[model samples]
Target: MFSPKLLLISAIAVALVGSILAISSLYANAQNDEEKAVNSRGMGYYQTTGDVLDPAGSSGSASTGIEPMKYLRTFNYGRVSTLPNGTTLREFTMIADDRQTMEISPGVHYNVWTFNGTIPGPTIRATEGDLIRIHLINNGTHPHSMHFHGIHRAEMDGVFETINPGGQFIYEFYAEPYGLHLYHCHVQPLEEHISHGLYGVYIVDPKTPRPDADEMVMMMNGYDTDSDGENNFYTVNGVPFYYMHHPIEIEKGRLVRVYLVNILEFDQINNFHLHGNLYHLYRTGTDMEPDDYTDMVTMSQGERAILEFTYQYPGQYMFHAHKTEFAEKGWTGMFLVKE
Candidate 1:
């Protein structure tokens, strides 16, 4: 027979152990909820699929015999009109999404304001001297206008004084200078406009023949959004991680060129890295002298870089920012090589 006091002591010890276990279980559950919330808050749900085409290989020609086009004509933007090639140029409306109140990425939900409900808007490619007529259709309450970076024409500068709600404006300018460039909202409260996500990349291929490889374009930007509170958002081509476009494809031992442009409101120093290839940066800005070249290049705000490289191996490789923070926030992409 146990003493009454001993029995009471044993009961108290058991109760204490049970309480500890229950508390631990509750804590773990709470932690899991927090993790899920964090993930849900970072989703920017968007996706697309298309076959990657090698500009070099598609146009059959030998390396030495390859001849670049002398001059390319620009495609005029119109109200959903068809091009001579049967391609269509249509009017687009960009709307803003609150990053603070919406769920975006996979397993993450956060508020973000985006153009046309998408980050980075759309990629606009045109030939030299093409008239680009973009009608600024402001769907959000905020006033917005777009400025073409590196474009010297005054009418296309997207002056705030020239914009109105639901008002349309035509930017008719020739793409005289060629290289990588950008266009973004330039209305007052510029910082707020950019932070809300209204920007994209523009590429003007040279009239001459390019290398015998693949071509890719990337636009880097940063944002700050309120989600339950304010949070920082950054991305390459409007998406973080591997969400935007999967690994970019290339042929083994073929040359590749990437046109990189940064249109962030703030000055950024972006360090680009390829997983298993060495790149030669050959040109910068709209004023690319005929045959200028450099192994590595750095571009400032409103600047561009043309990077050329050859893949020696066949696999999927990551190309991303050396800035770890950007990489975590989605400033990364993949480079793929096929045997």
Candidate 2:
């Protein structure tokens, strides 16, 4: 036996619990449907439901099979030499050549131009305020130059100082702006030079280091296999569909920092999208503050940004160009998060 007031309160509580459970079931169903839709789109390209391991395929003379950690994470600090005055100098030797054949994708080969015998060249890293030098050697028939995207003196600029066949030149400059940058061949028919794969990443680290994390770099590029002036195959770090099979492994709770660049020729714009989470984006990797907190970021040629994020749940996540064609054409990958 209960008082009339007590009975009313008990009835109300039961109805509230029933309503809450009903809402939860609906929400869970919605999540499942969304996931299924995403997987449906991936159908034959990639699968997020299985274990991802090192992919089995034909990589070229230089392969970014696993991307950044090997090709990019292995930074060339240059030959560090100290002066009599105790000043440290970083020096590099860059060679320009072309018509070298490389399998940009499985069963697809192209005549790639290179710096230091590799497409996208070497990842050059230096501290802000340091003096850096590049000794350029032109070993090919065509003239080539190293144009860096940073502040430097007029002569050090690689545009007018093109090196003819068998010739050499030196570019010396002070690293500044403490951000991500790039170097490329900037001769006449600039688009052709870049499209031919004559570029690499240049990084100037801030004096005060940012928070430590698992860091990596990505350079989005494309190849015109049939000379149609449009890209037939797109890639990250010179290989097609590399990371899709060999997912980037990371700890579940640690921060991941990515330095991403878009050097795709012909295409007006490209974009990067992360699945299951959003990230803080520092546009151009220049500012200390974030430009936006987003799941996708778009860029024009030579544009880059710094992305920082952490995953909460452990599983596989996909990353790709939000534009369907690019991802299907090979600009795609995955991240395996684990405890």
Candidate 3:
């Protein structure tokens, strides 16, 4: 008689083979589609009144010199809206697209999938108790969805709702318990999606509001250049050694607040180290009181904190991950203080 273990192994192998074959066929089709000749449309302005009325005797041809009838707005970040009754409404329209062989630093290039053509796409800002409405347009060739780490309803949750190509969805939620957060594509093969640069920083300011200070967003991310289940290059924003080349300028005797976020994949722990300074750290930005005061802080994947500090003396200061190898690999930056 055949052993039960042998039969189970045989069943698993057959299922794996079937799945591989299906995926291979899909890839072949996608390759073919990418090779098709695409007609380029000339840029022109057209009147859009939300009506489908066509011009008289107009032929559907590129030579017509008429642009497509669609509502288009400038791609930007940190958009806010307010009602007369003291309520705030934050709105954002995100377009997910993929670019081929985009430059990471100066000479390094990677196939980057992006939102609004930028890695670590636009930083979204909102105040506590405000409502956020995100209009996600799936203009790319694959399915995508936005999953935000905030309190929201199940339908508003992007996990079970995958929008196909040319589809759209509206995600609305109330921003509560203000803190540092992030948003990313939550489709299947989640790691691949995130590694492709489909993530961004989301900030919810506290209700009572901290003291006025110069603020900046620093999102830690890494790229798996060889697809080898390891990150070869790491960055604070998107480019390697960007801040090292062009240090962020700050004024002396002024408060500086940083929204620090870590979304680096394949790494369980990433820490921040500041040279010649200490910060009042607010863990997760959920409380009014700081949890500690220190020069270095560590966070696991998807963790964040709000760090506030002031430079008493003016000089150039460096900041990087405590993991020396990570800083050498490109996770580094500097703060140039002015007298």
Best by TM-score: 2
- Screening candidate 3 with a backbone cut-off below 3 angstroms (N, C-alpha, C), the clashing residue pairs are none
Q: Give the per-residue lDDT of model 1 (tens digit) for 29-119.
A: 3332212111122453222233322211211122211011110111223355556975444444444333333323333344444555555
RMSD of each: 11.5, 18.4, 19.9
In candidate 2, position 319 carries an lDDT of 91
Ranking by TM-score: 2, 3, 1
List candidate 1 segments past 4 Å from native.
1-104, 110-115, 227-231, 243-245, 265-267, 285-297
Clashes of 1: 25
Q: TM-score of model 3 relative to the true fold?
A: 0.75
Residue-level error in angstroms, candidate 2, position 183: 0.8
- Backbone clashes in model 2, listed as residue pairs: none
Task: Name the best candidate (by lDDT).
Answer: 2
When 1 and 3 are scored with lDDT, the better candidate is 3
Q: Residue 182's C-alpha lDDT in candidate 2?
A: 91
Stretches of candidate 3 above 4 Å error? Answer: 1-86
